[model samples]
Target: MSRVVFTLALAASGLLAQAPTPGPLVRLYPVALDANGQPVTDLTADDFKIVDQTKPQTILAFHKPRNEPAAPHEVLEFSNRTSGVTPHATVILFDMINLLDADRLANWKALDKALPQLESGESVYFYVLNLEGALLPIHAISPPAAGDKTWPQGVATGFDKVMKASSHIRQAQIGAEEQVKRTFKALEDLANKLAAFPGRRDILWVANGLTTVPDPMLPHCNGDWVECSLYVPHLGVTLAKDRVAVDPYALVGNISPDVNYNMDQMALLTGGHFYSRQDVRAVVNQVTQGAVGGYSIFYDPGPDNWNNKWHRVHVTCERKGVKLQLRERYYALPDSRPAVERMKAVLMEAFQNPTDLAEIGVRTKISPLPDGKPGVHLDIRIDPSDLLLREQGGKYSGALYCLVSDRSATAPLGEPSVLDLKPELTAEQYKMVMKNGLPFMQDHPTSDTAREVRVIILDQNTNAVGSVTFSVK
Candidate 1:
């Protein structure tokens, strides 16, 4: 992945504060297949039970896939929903980084033959998992097409580019250890990107299986300290070194377990499926034909301590002869600075992609600044209620982290700003703030060549993000 550098500056505002209390609600996307391996869509909330850490939890809401709008509207509406378990779109991820040359070619051939069978009303996205561990979107096929028997022109063009890029991976001289790291990094990045989209995304991962872990004894450890040895002169002992053997397959041995676990977890968490060296054409056909069925179950797993623990989840149905395909565990994110900082880093990495994180609602306006330094006055409006806030000393408080970048140059146009929302307001002032929304304005210096401006905002309390892009003419 590429690094996005930003110079951050704090704007004096009242909202700067610590994290808020953890919220309720843990959502799960589970697909139930009968003895025949077909989706059981008729199951209701009463027919299902969810166990978190072996404790039965109430199912607060359940949504089964239903008829939705076609094409662009369907994509737009699905992405915009505040809550619900609707089927979003299918993202066919070609993991070229992990697949051997022959497997890559075979999977490519499978996809080539299966593209024409895509459902006309479904939005399907194509991505190539590059060696750098990024799920790069090549093309998106929306609905209302002439027929299901053909692919859009863009799909053909994009697939060609994807194949061309992936072909080089076959010749690239990357070791198994490096490959393992890149593959999982790609999966992790892909999950974060998909989280912004509402509803369940069927990720048809096409690749040979990846190593679940990488060897800790490998030389030039690539920042993986666990695999790096530490020589302590005082103790006269080398820690974390079993032997100095140049075993090419060592990476595979170390990573295979983790790769398997992550693949399964990724599928469950994203409400997708993992297909390892399977008949890609058949899987695509099955997915497009609606042969697979699932339900989105939302429930409150209760309050979390944010101690960064993995909570196990088990789902079963009252109906007999049904097999559940779902993620077995979910990690509770750490509330500490390290974890939050890591999340911020991940969010910054995702900024390089074309998709904007619009999970949180936001509106922006930009006008030329009067100072005449090729600058613009930017204004943003955010609803206070949409944010998670804590009350202390008779005042509401929150923090907002904002980033403004020149997309044309892929550089920060101005220092990133942090706005604090500590307000000890009177009853009338509180009403006004709630009624009118929290408003923020800043002047940013821009170059004459800048064609686009990207603004990203992160809610410190909830970690919710909202982003907007403006074209400069």
Candidate 2:
């Protein structure tokens, strides 16, 4: 519930995705106010500045303080794709992965009590980190009335519910290896979920905030490892293989590091707010009441079809003396290149198998199926083949993995399809010879017919060698 304002030295690049014509660019106004937690309705548009990087961009439009009942703010816009759904989405990540502090712990309890009282009009997704440190969508709620279908009272509240969920998960009682996959899959589900929604949305992340983990310098490991924790006291860190060992009373938040980048980028690019894990009371109050009645700025950088690049956006107050708060920036839709280009540029460096796969090839498909919902339907299939391992002498041996990345610009999205290709073969490879792959529901296909999907692939060692943009659309 705490607020964080990051003022960065801007850098310039022509990396923005091609945006649709100027209209209503989803804008989140960070209303700065006095310490009393009241809206400073006196501020006007003249008190704000919009900057892309260091260079200030003109604020195309602005609005004064408005309430929820003041006519639902015309924020929704349509995209030009086959379906007119806007590609905007956001998430509020409740980072409870390693909170061990008593005070912050109390804050979390306070939040639980406040959630029912909080009010919001838009549909935002709630994601939490399991004991294993994997992010998962616990539930997606639409403001006040549309609470969780299962638990109409709403998601769990209090330390017991949160800790119990973590304990059960840690004991391998639930969500095992799938925990890691959830880190990526949660995003994918969110993106697809957003696609199902009508307009653009932003993710608002709330946590005990971020801090550092225990380092070897501590009496425990003796310089062998580092400590990881959250931004506030009373918040503890969750260890992968051990129970709580570190004390939260001994830690404090640092600015240089401790901030979670993965969570940051996920929300930033999609036009979401990354609420720091500070002042639990303030954070809870902020989330309950939408924005603080600040300046709502909007811009249309021009149809963003390419869903692949990290675009940087900045907002500055044109008026001096008045402080301005906004998300660090936003990432644009990805580049429109075939899968190969994306792998070479982004995926290859991280995904290669250790042994020595010199090159890799990828294929993808999306199958549509009938669903109760009305929207694009998809059953995604990714095939990774033609892997060449690094040759040691005359013998070629190594493990290869094929990963399918499902990410969309519209939602808090991600899903990774990893295929272990240790034994490679041709289309006539062997008995049952189906391509080793993973299938996921991409979009709920209109009919029962699935659509062929296109995916970018990466080799363990080499960059992108080839891509399969196959489709049944």
Weakest ten-residue segment in model 1 by summed lDDT: 239-248
The positional error of residue 297 in candidate 2, measured at the CA in angstroms, is 2.9
Task: Name the TM-score of candidate 2.
Answer: 0.38
Quality of model 2 by C-alpha lDDT: 0.36
Q: Best-fitting candidate, measured by lDDT?
A: 1
Candidate 1 structure lDDT: 0.52
Candidate 1, residues 112-163: lDDT per residue as tens digits?
A: 6556554442455566877656667765433332123345333656787767
In candidate 1 the C-alpha lDDT for residue 62 amounts to: 60
**Clashing residue pair totals per candidate (backbone < 3 A):** 19, 76
**Over 4 Å off, model 2:** 1-37, 40-47, 61-65, 68-128, 132-166, 171-281, 288-294, 300-314, 332-473
Note the Cα lDDT for every prediction shown: 0.52, 0.36
Clashes of 2: 76
Best by TM-score: 1
